[model samples]
Target: MTLDPLAALAGLGFGLSLIVAIGAQNAFVLRQGLLRRHVLAVVVVCAASDAVLILLGIAGAGVVFAAIPWLTTAVRIAGAAFLLGYAVLAARRAVRPRALEAGDPQASPGLAATVLACLALTWLNPHVYLDTVVLLGSVANTHGDSRWLFGAGAAVGSVLWFTALGYGARLLQPVFARPAAWRILDAVIAVVMAGIAVSLLLGL
Candidate 1:
């Protein structure tokens, strides 16, 4: 069967939008990227982890959302709340930008420790599941038979994003050292999250 371009595009757009945010997982990836410590391994783990979770959401989580319509509404409402709260944090960070603490590459932990920390940050966090399994899953299911295509798009996005972030972080070091850079980034995040939250609530 031919894949629906619209469905795939929708998935890619939504997946990138959802994943490109200030979160524990992204922060870890950013830090690892900056340090240049196990960059390939870290990137692979994150992208692979996201692919697995996306499958769970697209294949199974959507089923749960289907069985309970009320839960879907609740999850949407909760997602809105999550987005708004994320916006608040981003706004606060923009007001008080943090200093770059990438530290010495020589002092970075061993590969095992680094991988374990990355795993902990990604899997142990509840927010990951919310974003991927619940929110993305529900939205993908709405696409009907094209949902897997949507999921595939999302997986592709995850791979692309992690690869870019991991590989491109070195280029950002000089600029990111300035607090002003973080302030601008946080401000953009705030606006994006707030707009998304407001739109989600309006849809409900």
Candidate 2:
């Protein structure tokens, strides 16, 4: 039941490894950061969502995910499809450079919507379950009763990372203001998303 420092460190490292990858959540965070629009809100939603999932994983949700083979397969297919769709959308945005709507200096996605979006992005994706719940949880297995501490460490890491990424991206806002820069970024996102989708589909 005691907190094992080694297990906590392993869990923290594993959590960070899975999160640092580029994905829809990262893309959204970067956009919000660069626009200085809802940056804090995005971070709160993302971090809290991760905390919940990480806890669930520590509580053996990974076993549930693994138990249902068909469900896992469905999630994989769905996640791949969503990635491809998002890729197409990104490519369209790149081709048709449209002016972004004036960000409401005060307007923001409602708390409910923000929470829902975060949960959907974090939970609905099979990759999240596979990486955080399964992979990271497996690392905490040695902690036995102290698995909660491991999950806590992982949650703390998620909070730290999201905050850094959200705010760090704002530093590049001035450079991204250029229309060409936006186009290029969109193109890059499209390519990345497409590549991820292909990788998932091929089970790579």
Candidate 3:
């Protein structure tokens, strides 16, 4: 099948626009990237999960999700709880900040725990479903037969964004070398997490 370049570009742009926002997932990714703690695993999970979700959306999972409102409601409750818990953790980290030094064995979490947290941050968040499955799916459908191409483009966009965010974060290593920087970042992450949690609880 011939891919539509225009459709692909449009998908790329749209996907980046959505994922680049200062949301819970991005905040978690940024923190992990800055810490260089299991950065590769985290980036792969996020980007791959997004690709799968966007494809599902393009495949009409949005309609199925809408038809079963209860599923979303259940996920919403779980997501809110998870976000709130994460916010508290971030708040504690902010209150007692640690410098994000690479290879600092004491400061970094194990790979299993980090991967689990990353998965939770990705899958447990309802906005992911809304954005990728529902919203992106709806938009892709507008392209008619070219919708799959749009989805493919979006998948590419996800890969690029996550790769950049994860790897490009190394450039900020100098700044995060200071404990003060870590404190500030954790505080911001706490606020973002709490705000998202409240929004989920309020059904926003």
Pick the lDDT winner.
3
Q: Rank the candidates by TM-score, best first.
A: 3, 2, 1
Q: Which residue segments of model 3 deviate by more than 4 Å? A: 1-3, 97-103
Candidate 3 positional error at 14, Å: 0.8
Model 3: worst 10 consecutive residues (lDDT sum): 97-106
Writing each residue's lDDT as its tens digit, candidate 3 over 22-100 gives: 9988887888888777888988999999999998998899998789988898898999999899999888877763433
Q: How high is each candidate's TM-score?
A: 0.66, 0.84, 0.94
Over 1-204, each residue of candidate 1 has an lDDT whose tens digit, in order, gives 455779988989999999897665676577578667799999999999998989999877746755877765665576667667656866776775242234534335789987886776566444577789888988988888899999999999999999999889889989867767766766776786677567657766
Minimum summed lDDT over a 10-residue window in model 2 is located at 99-108
Colliding pairs, model 3:
none
Clashes of 2: 0
Which stretches in model 1 have alpha-carbon errors above 4 Å? Answer: 1-3, 62-106, 175-204
Candidate 2, residues 14-120, lDDT tens digits: the string is 67888998887887677667667667888998888888778777778888877888888777777778778767876876776453322533222555665565555
> What local lDDT score does residue 13 receive in model 3, on the 0 to 100 scale?
93
